[model samples]
Target: MEKLQVLDITGLSFTSLPLSIELLENLKSLCLDQCRLEDVTIIGKLKGLQFLSFLDSTIARLPKEIGGLTELRFLDLTGCTELKVIEPGMLGNLVNLEELYMENSFDQWEAEDKVPRSNASLAELKNMKNLSTLSIAIPHSVNLLRDLPFGKLNMHKIQIGEVWDCLCMHKESRTLELKLDSSYLLLEEWVQKCLQRAQDLHLGGLQDGNDSIHDLCIEDAEAEDGDEIDDDPKVKSCKLRRLTLRNLPMITSFYKRADYPVDLFDAQQLVFLVTSIIMNSVGYSPFAVNEATSLEAITIERCQLIRKVFDLEGLTTNEEVEILSRLRELTLSDLSSLEYIWNKNPQRASCFQNLRTLKVQNCENLRFLFSSSMAKALKQIKEIEIVSCDKMEEIINVQEEELEEAKSADTLNFPILTFLSLEELPNLRTFSYEKYDIHYPSLTRLTISSCPKMMTFSSSERKQQLMRADIGLQQAFGHINSGLSLPVFFNEKVLFPRLEELKLSSMCRLKRIWHNQLPEESFCKLTSFTVELCENLSHVFPSNSMDRLQSLNKIEVVGCPSLEALFEWVCLSSEKRQTPLVLSALKKIKLWNLPRLRDVLKSDRKVNFKSPCLMEVDVRCCHSLPYLFSSATARSLRKLAILEVSVAITYGA
Candidate 1:
């Protein structure tokens, strides 16, 4: 029988089947995901079989005859919980194999006899001369295969990086991968010597057995009591740049004298740094953090110990400052213990000269984030992202009232900030700066999400910041849509000059987008606006202020069910003067998932869009929408797509 080209038997619940799979001589692809099976014995007879997958299936063992399928190229067996072993000599004949995936539980095995039995099990795979890619879960560590005969074959194009029972491969090889849960603790001296040849190195995975971080730290403390150790040799032979360590629990401190000392010398040319769960607790002063002059990006996660290391001031010198100053991208996540960063006195803080991107997430314990002095340190930063930080009482904590009273005193603040993103925060109510001026001339994009408790910016509720324009209360508050009205007791509002994109999503309690405060001049450069999931917003951008929004290009409203109208009022005097002038710049309009929007254009609807400039209009999933740009406006509409929407356009003859 010819092999099957494609066999998709997904979601099949079969416990046993005939071992006749080898009869499919021309099979090119086979998928039995989620099937319940025990063994794959019939697969060996399929001489032309190429691809096979049993992901999420229950299979325990493979027949030794599996090696007979020389034409097989890809094989996957991820999530096969019953798979206990790979039969010995089942893979040596698969010379044409290119990719192999095995998601097995090899880390839980403990018996010493179980180790060799597993080794003897894989004796056939070493003969696959043409194998290019291999992804598998080792029973313990990669060191177990160090003595295997794989030395004869040179791997190319692909490399295996995982957290297994293997010591760091100090070897200089290509195509590298290093996982975070490996067998680094069981590594002997000989294994380390052999790994010194790998070129691309991956440093990841926590140590197993006595490798528990708490235990390792205690052991190191006891051993270091002996004497003053000097001349800690370096591993300079390994030229590694790409490093990834995930879930490294013992990283409370980076170095130790008896175990592993500070290793900045290895991989000095690193360009990327990523780590997860780095809890640095080893309390040693002047910690050995190498200077990565070539470092461009660094990501830190849940590293509680970082607070002490970066606690700068007169304590560190220029060389240390220069190291962090060169970084461009920095992402900090889940560092819950971080209070105040940088020096208490702003003048001594390290400056990030090339740093453009800064992302901070889930730092719940972070209090006053930026001091006026520290804000001056990040002058080069353009993009800033803060999310899920519940304890952020204030950004620049100094009282604004006190600062204005002393404005004559020269104070430096963040003036270069351009892009800002705030999301998933509950307690962040204000971002007021009093002692220092916070201005962003280059500001363009602002994205705010899931901030329920946030009311507004500034303290005095009465004084507005630079807002100078006339806009309708209903329109500005259209972002708040239906039920509740945004209270605008203050006369002035905030101003954004160069902003092009503004996104507000899921503000459930928001009754209005802005207070009915007036501005000096309209936001001239405002172009694109997006409002989503704000159910209460009823009307926005009154027709009178339509001319002031001359640069408005596009507006999108999605999932705002409570909004029944787009615009409520229009000034007749202003309309007659314009002489039916088109909203010449408006390009696109999209309205989706708004169940309350029953009409697009009504006789009383004074809304006018520049249809000549409008290229596309998409109205989808709005079941009640009727009419096409009030018979007065549809003349210039070029393209229209209506999905799951009902439209009624009545032409009055």
Candidate 2:
């Protein structure tokens, strides 16, 4: 017991410490996390106590007598919301404290001008010369010391004015979450010093004298001109890792300073950022966004006035900078006024080569996400989820004849794409309408739901984009049809070789998922297939690639009133060379509500359906289904264990 170096008493309630508790004179660390206590100056008896923690505790006060523990090197009072007082001279006495955490704790700090001190104050921190880490929240800054040299702390998380949820990390470097009154937004020396070194900053509740909240000087972390920030945005070498702007209801623009060449957030060091848009500035932007290499993620949500995220239009710059080269994630949600993700001009010098995940939701006004030129650079993208954007007609907007001319042989490939979800897009027509051969070689999971108007995968032939403008003009002058019509989705090519699951629902106008006959290697590995509410779809697979469904393990078709047959080429093939229709690995099939489904497989002769592994079949509400399969095909389902037929079945279909 005498050699005890650590003692932790967690989740207990007590009024005072027992006399025997003080016997551990060699205890260097004492943790009373989440405890309740009123009075116990007995902690002072442990002269060897170097580390003390009252994390999330209900200790109302810190007895001044315990300040005699000058050997204390660390003290934590984080989340001690009930703690209101630290007796005067208590903290000043602990000169050896290397790390002190008092976040969300006592804030009734006695001002330096008080006649008689009743509780501890900021002046107490002056003697903590060895303190290198400080995490504190000060809701009341009126009595703060104007000369507090917080720059001396090697690592600090300081919240000065208003308080928010403390989710931002400290990164073992400086972090500041400031939301002070209008007067305090000025670059006070100490505040400026904090800004200069802050790796993560969360600024909210800022208002100028006229309540305009237009303070671009904060972006210039290196500026020395007190309040004279010039119109030309300064290009400061910033090291900010994350920035969050909240509740600023006036600044409307994002990344553009309208008529000026302002490079405000061109820090080239921002890792993650949150922006705010508000009230009424018909059009605004984060003017002149210079390319940054350190930004990893960006989330812009609920910005009512934002129309565009990245607008590089009319930029005539000669220098090239890769756009957010390290950014891995980008999310935009609930921006009602959002019309474009990227404007007419894709930054010719930029690329999204490293962005892996993109999620967009509830932005009703957005028409398209990426142009063909913007999409060509997304080689590392893996996951994309876009939902409820009413005006979204396509994922990629095909450029006019001129821009599409030279992009014929280009392959817009998502090499590592694994998952894609597009839901509730009422007006969505297709993924793309033109010029390039889109590839999803590694796609595994795909879900498309409620896209009622979507009928084609891609309509444009790459050769069309290659046609010369002179030829196009001549063709137009002659009024001759080059024989171009809206083609069906999923053309004749090898795509999605690694696809595992495909689910489609509520596509009322979808007559075909694919029309052209694809190669045998395409969709060869698809395991599970599901389609529902697609009333116009007649068949599932193309005839040429039907034999490649050896890997399909499950199928569920429901509510497809026009589905006459489940598989293509259901009639028996006469040639001996023809490959027999085989679902060798199929395990389950569910057919329901298909009023017009005539048969699953119809074989007139020996080329019958052979599903040696088919186990379960469920058929219901198919009043018009003539038969499930031919007698030869039915006999091949030897492993079928469970068969469910509804009362509406004719002769137990």
Candidate 3:
């Protein structure tokens, strides 16, 4: 036991460390996490211990003897809920301590006697000047802040309870984070003092009052005029690089009032500002930053009363205001009342030119992501994701006037867009209401699911173009014209030209994958296609287009009960049938829970399975299929490495 260099008694039921533990003089690390440890006097005897952890334990008090561990460098007491008091001078002896974590550890400190004693114990932390990281709850007493060596210590990272309590922080400290409760009040003097020094500042639970940031600045300026000029150096501008405000229910706007000076955004060097659960006040916009050019990212979540993120009406100047030009990422989530990301302004569209990624989720009131005019200016956007928005009808909403103008134009293009995912939007009708030859040349992946009302993937104008192209459609099987009125794929236009993967699910009204004949160059790069729970879908691909899908390797169809066949071969004469449909790259096919499926192909025309890499065929619960392939096509399945057929009534017959 004396030779043991590491001791781990974690998750044990022991209430106290064994006295024999003191014999391990060479022990350098000790872990008692998730144990019933109420006493740790034996730990102090391990003079060589450098690391000590008591996470999630029931220990009520730390032994005063803990100061004797002079070699201790890392101490973690996180989640020790019962721990309330620490003896004075306990931490003063840990001169070599580099990191200390005590988050949610002391719950009884709110009582009278425990508060002062705990403050004194915390004051001892100043003696350990080597502490680079510290996380602790600051007491409400003013003397505790004055007595603590915050201005002298060189802590690079610190997390405290209240900002006002730690007003005396070291100006040289690089980072400070405050996690205040809802009841805590934010003083302007303390906030301005901290912002002048902290490089990265995070504030939470800042209650609203007349003492807003603008009011604070006004008071500070008045005081500066009354005082004599001194030689003491101070940060002239807001030096904070990152500012995060969370759970601030009282703050409605970035500024208290619209008439306030714009210097709040101009003077700050902030690169990122993230706010969550911060309600927008009745008459103010959530993002009122008009001159924040240095901001690179802005994320707002669960902010109420935010009808639109940017309020252009509040701006004094109409002259092409360049706001958030350097921003690379923007995210908005769970804002129930959010109607638009940015107010529909043609001039302000240029602000999003540098944005690379945009994500919006659970914004139920948002009818559209962006207007058509704004979409045109988002040339740098590489990825767009929208999910669980119940009211979202379109991604790029085109007004009636814009639709008329688009019809006269050549094309609507998303030049650099590579990834698009739309999910759980039940009322979505189309990507656009009136499409004018929409093109996505760089798009590689596409996903659409749970959009039951989405019958067609094309715009109303594009559908009319297909209907005008004279594509003959003689109603044949099942319900004839009773299916959805729109086609699953676009008619004459080639959407997602570079698309590599496609997923479609729960689209109850889908009838055909494509309405009209696609150009030979269409879907040339598509490698995978999946369709599931689309009960109204009858066929996977149109008749003669299989020859164009040379890159298709995998196909999956599951729970599509009305699907009668995989391909609908048009009235191809016997002479044309001689030119076999060859899928050169096809490797895998999965058909599951499709009760009405009869054959893989509806016609007797031969399909030449020329893919040497073809390996799998999985068919289960498809009771009506006599065979997956026709007699001639079945010969090709003999070379497959995996041919799984279960509960399929007559698969081999």
Please give the CA lDDT of all the candidate structures.
0.51, 0.70, 0.64
Query: Against the correct fold, how does model 1 do in TM-score?
Result: 0.53
**Which regions in candidate 3 have their CA more than 4 angstroms from the true location?**
1-85, 92-179, 188-251, 261-297, 313-322, 345-349, 400-407, 460-488, 515-522, 573-575, 604-612, 647-653
Error of 3 at 259 (Å): 3.8
Highest lDDT model number: 2
lDDT of 3 by residue, 44-154 (tens): 888899999988888877777899999999998888878877766677799999888776665233322364464235546767877766666553432233334443233
Candidate 3 TM-score over all chains jointly? 0.70
Superposition error at 75 for model 3 (Å): 7.9
Clashes of 3: 1
Model 1, 296-371: lDDT tens digits are 4555565543342234334333333333445676776776665654433323335556677888888887765665
lDDT of 1: 0.51
Distance (Å) between predicted and true CA of 45, model 2? 3.2
Give the local distance difference test score of model 3.
0.64
lDDT score for residue 510 of model 2: 64
